[model samples]
Target chain A: MTDITIDHVTKNFAIDGRSVTAIDDISLKFPSGSFSALIGPSGCGKSTLLRLVADILAPSAGKITIGGTPPDEARRRHEIGFVFQDASLLPWRSVMDNIALPLEIAGGPIGDGPRPETLIRLVGLSGFENAKPAQLSGGMQQRVSIARALVLRPKILLLDEPFGALDEITRQRMNMELLRIWQETGTTAILVTHTIGEAVFMADQVHVLAAHPGRLVTTIDVDLPRPRALAMLQTPAFNHLENAVRAALFGDELKAEPEPAHG
Target chain B: MVGPVVFVVVLLALWKLAVTAFAVPPYIMPPPEAAWTAFLKEADKIGYALFFTLRNAAAGLLVAFVLAIVLAAIFVSSRKVTHAVLPIVIGLRTAPVLAIAPILIMIFGRGIGTAIAVVVIVSFFPIMVNAMKGFSSTRKNALELMHVLGAGWFKTFIKVRLPFALPFIFAGLRSAATSAILSAMLAEWLSGAPGLGTLILDASSYRKTGLLWAAVIVSMIMAYTIYWLTTAVEKRLTAWRN
Candidate 1:
């Protein structure tokens, strides 16, 4: 449970003898014990920014201080956990083994411990201990990945479209499940998503990034209410926030179009 | 039973028809009934020979399995060595096993050991190549999951990488099993105590074409048995794939 402060984070990728800027001069701060959603149109560097915070990719310029230390330092000591859009659970590993992966990597005594049993229950994967990834459904497999990321008990969890591959019904159920898990665990989550409704439903703050030399366009705080149910999505307040996020994205798309031939 | 049984029946019928149509002498080509009668009369000898070849085939397959896995592990652990040595391994696979059998016989003599060695050499390449390809085919997402979870290189290899490679390795084994039986018989033709190869040679020398046809049938059964055994193992190990 800690804050992640990004100070002028910029990312450049080397491609075909040219450097392409993915994220440019973006400064954002995610406070402690809060669920923040990074919402943006595709290719707006939302994933790139999340990867930088997860320490998977280093920024070409600028610094990110995670929990008062560099993400590089944070990740190595296993202070941050990350999940990709793909469930990414090892096909060969059973659910228990997948969940126990962090402990195995951390190289500690793996025995009857209080935390391990509690974690299995927390994810609602009680009877699926021996089930392999291939044996489970898409939703169940994603749950294993989530359990694995949280196994290390990191303060910050970074997710890059973790439910993008699941069906709409599954995704909605997952959002509810995720909220339940977060409420119980109190771990700060930074979810990078494209769904405006999802952003409004999940986040305390939704940070929107606009493309074409990608940078943050706006940040909107959702003071809607706590324990936000799926039913809240149809409310006027949710509609208002969704419209705001939609307008911000629409404005960016409008600006990105090639201008009509001028004299 | 479905495809191969139909294939064997068609093949035997064609051979019988050719023998009758050409008016081929009994010593040259025996009819299906005569071949069947000869096969029953000499069942004990054929059975013994079949057992001998099977023993050699099983031994060879085991040897090839061990060697292929070790080589694959070595190649995977060190990329530079794999890049350096892979072409030569592919070249070995290209060399026909029959072409090399006599040369191997000259070196090791026409004994069971030579027969086993020939089968091992013949079968090793496919297993090694399949294992390499299977391990490398591990999904990138699966790997990232392991990495983020803190699984080390060896742990990742055994738990994640190895199980994923099982289907491919078994596929190679199923393919190699056929070659394994063929190579063992080829080696037995050159040397060995008393296998189907010896029966074939004795029948050919005595002008007993019917007995030779029977020996051929026994050997075919031996080869298919290996194939089916491997296929069964494949089915059990990779029930998840289906």
Candidate 2:
């Protein structure tokens, strides 16, 4: 079990010699093999939180742990996988080479992890193994990045708006693909996104966050069934859950607004 | 290609016209035919001098390329080292090669060593500066990806930084190549080396204006050829950009 635990983690950035709190003290737990989503508006520190979990950035205060180990140790052990907003594939490298990069960095394949070829097939990119990133579309490039992130078979997967740049149809298709991939790997997954529908669709639990001093406002449980399909998106249950998450996300602002009587 | 050929033909025609119309003295502005005749008559001597200059320039340019890449890597590896040494590098670059050539000749004597040293001094700055820029210009997300993968600094540099910097390094090399021949010739003039520059000097002193013009044209051709070669190599290596 490789659960992620964030204990009162806070991040502060010094801008122009003034301390700005990006993330207020926030605590959350992602159970082993569970899918979670962090949904909030811009400046909500969701990406920062993901970075903190991946050990790419250290928390200014508090601590983050994976399973029973610190994030850095987990990272050093090659237990963390992160996907950025951009694909970030090396332009000169082919799809196979880019996916195999982590394995090469680890000195070799780690404990029988999937081969680059296997990952190419897994990501539905079998014939284009030798294709350069430039030749591929944005969606295909993101697919390569996803394969790269999973190449090592990491225990925790952290995605910071990995599909934020795609069109709506592509985004929805990718969301379904990601869900399928998440279930197959059973890795503790956390997605940071600003889209409410995506958060509700992919996550078992939606953690709503507020900005200014980014802090968690609420966590809404999605009792949606496993092996979810596109048809479920139109169901009353999914709509109810979406509304619940939306309320948690904007409840304070809604309350602060003056009431309208005639309407 | 056709356009450049036409342009060159028109230029030659204008040169011939100017010499005939102005009745320019041969010592000051030799006719095109006289220069061509002189090139044919002294082909062996001029070819030998051209070969000597090119060899020295190639050697110096190679040394400068390796040194620039190594120094750029060192500078990028540590902020403290970069801050401490970059100012010194810039100061050295600011010193005129002509001013340093005499000192170099005094130290290395009138030999190939002085010629090569002069070439290196005149040609290394652009490559070094561009290499530094290339190494630093790697995307932030790419570096973060490397860190997340647990790649050490050396591995990251080899796998990420070096490849990313190739285009910029080639840009530096293209500029450097254009100057390599010119600096080698300048060195030959100071050191009394058997090179195109010395040949031009001897021809001018004897009032062989046609031979002098021929040597100048050959040197220009050599410089353009080197620049074209660098561009070709850059295109081949950086084909992924397309």
Candidate 3:
């Protein structure tokens, strides 16, 4: 497990000869072994921040370090794993091969981590080892991707709306699956999501971001009990945290519009 | 198999009926029975010609297959190379191979090698174009996944791009298989060689209507067989797609 520190990082993209800042001078620290979620409206740079930490994009200013090492170095050392919105498994490869991809890329003797077969079972895909990605349903495909991401046993895992495409029931099931996997692995996880409930339920801390030169508006620490059960969602405490995150987003939206309520 | 055989038999029966019903002149259109008789009488000669032409077609397709793969690789490696070479290929592909055949015969003289060359020229482009499209059509996220895995360019091409391109390549091969025989026969016709194309020409010149019809039918059967064979190969290789 490793801590990720973002020190005043900013990202700007040039379009039509005009500069647009996606993430604007945001700073935060994700201590080792913490589960943090960045949630806000679309275009609030949640995905961009996760991408920066994954070393997929470079910061225009400031720095991001993983366990006191640069993001690039951590990525090169295979300490960072990422899951995109889509499962993105190669359709030709079977479930086992897809999960084994990271190990194949690493190209060495089996490291001291969970094996690919073990991960297939971990993701609840034990019987379909030889089945191609096309044969599996969307949720099953996402599980394969999750197993693939964890195959390298990365120190930190980053997810960008990994379950956004699933139905609500499947999404909740995957959420529980992810929580169990996280607990078992003890790996630091950073998720970029648009769902307030998901962030509150899944994260140790939630960072609410605001759009239009995206910046972090606030960080809410989830004071929920550890080894959270599904029943916790029905509790008053979970509802309160969910309401607080929703209110922050609603307030940001209202502040941008500058309109009064008629009713 | 039974369906094609039945359809062909019915078509042949209709042709026989037409010839007998209309009392058509043998010179204009020989009766189906006359062609069948000719095929039986010259069975040894016809079989040799069939083997020779089929060999030419197979050899030409093999050469074209290799050339297409190499050129497709080059084309995929750099846009500059594709830009420089593709216009000429498109030009060659669009212009009739028949027009180029006479000039090639004039330059290289009448030989089996010249015929093979013409077949190669006629059949290589489709494979190149299709294979190029296939190799380039690798999913963007697949490439990004490779990048995240720290996979090198060669590994990405072999493991991802190549497999993705197989179905397309097979599609190209099916088309090329049909064209291979046609180009070989055309080459033989221009070069005055000993294959079925030359047999057709000789029969026409000698006014042997039965022999001419028989040779044409033989050529049709060869084309059909090659098409079927290619389809079978494609099915076996890409069973996963089903």
Interface RMSD, all candidates in order, equals 2.4, 0.7, 1.7
Single out the weakest 10-residue window by summed lDDT for candidate 3 chain A: A102-111
Give residue B43's error in model 1 in angstroms: 4.4
- TM for every model, in the order presented, reads 0.82, 0.95, 0.88
- Candidate number of the best DockQ: 2
RMSD of each: 4.4, 2.1, 3.2
Query: What is the DockQ score of candidate 2, to 2 decimals?
Result: 0.88
TM-score of chain A of each: 0.92, 0.96, 0.95
- TM-score: which is higher, 2 or 3? 2
Task: Report clash pairs, candidate 1.
Answer: none
Name the DockQ score for candidate 3.
0.39
Q: What CAPRI class is candidate 2?
A: high
Report the poorest 10 consecutive residues by lDDT, candidate 3 chain B: B144-153
Rank by TM-score (best first): 2, 3, 1
Which regions of candidate 1 deviate over 4 angstroms? Answer: A1-10, A16-18, A25-28, A58-80, A90-141, A166-170, A231-263, B1-18, B33-44, B70-79, B96-113, B190-194
Q: Which docking category, incorrect, acceptable, medium or high, applies to candidate 1?
A: acceptable
Shift of residue B56 alpha carbon in model 3, Å:
2.7
